[model samples]
Target: MPRYFTDEHEWIDVEGDTATVGITDYAQGQLGDIVFVELPRVGSEVARGKDAAVVESVKAASDVYAPITGEVTEANGALEDDPALVNSSPEDQGWFFKLTIANKSELDGLMDAAAYKSFCDSL
Candidate 1:
C-alpha cells in the first residue's frame, strides 16, 4: 500500500481503489488525549478537502478532512468506545474510515512520506 499525507494532517493509505484514512501521529500528539470521535456514515460521499469526521481531545476538537473525494465504505466502530486508540496507534487501529477513491489523480496533489515529513519538520 502507498500512503499519502495532506496539509490538514490527514493520512491515506491506498490499496487498489480504496483508501484507509486517519490522522497523522503528529496530529494525535498535538491533540493530546482523544476522548471522542464522530465518524461519517458509510455510503456518504465526501469531497476532497471537506470535513468528513470529528475528533475531540482533552485539548480541543479537530475536524478530520477528506484527503480525496470518494464514498465512505466503512468507519472504524472501535473508535466510538475507545477514542484513545488514536493516541496510541493513529496509523493502524485508529484509522477513521475507508473510502472508495473517486479520482486517483487527486492523490498527486498530496505529499509522500518524505515530503510530508519535511512539511511537518518545517512546522
Candidate 2:
C-alpha cells in the first residue's frame, strides 16, 4: 500500500482500487482535542479536492477533503463514539472512509510521504 497526502492535510492510503482516507497527524494536532466527526455515508460520491467530511475539535471544525474522485465504500462508525481516536490514531482506526477510486490518475496529483513531509516542514 502507498500513502499519499494533500496540501490541505488529508491523507489516503491506497490498496488496489480502494483508498482509506483520513486527516493527517499534523492536522489533528492543529485541530486540538477532537470532539466530533461528520463522515460521508457509504455509497456517496465525492469529487477530487472537495470536502468529504468534517472534524470538530476544541479549536474549530475543519474540513477533510478527498484527494481523488471516488464512491465511498465505508465509513468508520466508531468515530461517533470515540472521536478522540482521531488524535490517537489518525492513520489507522481513525480513518474516515474507504473509497472505490473513480480515476487512478488522480492519485498522481497527491504528494508522497517524503514530499508531504517537506510540505509540512515548510509550514
Best of the candidates, TM-score = 1
Instruction: Give the per-residue Cα lDDT of candidate 1 at 104.
Output: 97
* Model 1, residue pairs in steric clash: none
Which 10 consecutive positions of candidate 2 have the poorest summed lDDT? 58-67
Residue-pair clashes, model 1 = 0
Error of 1 at 58 (Å): 1.6
Q: Write model 2 residue lDDT over 3-38, tens digit each, in one string.
A: 999998889999999999998899888999999999
Off by over 4 Å in 1: none
lDDT of 1 by residue, 34-115 (tens): 9999999999999998899998888788888898999999999999989999999998999999999999999997999999
Compared with the true structure, model 1 gives a TM-score of: 0.97
- The 10-residue segment of model 1 with minimum total lDDT is 56-65
Model 2 scores a TM of 0.96
Instruction: Score residue 115 of candidate 1 by CA lDDT.
Output: 96
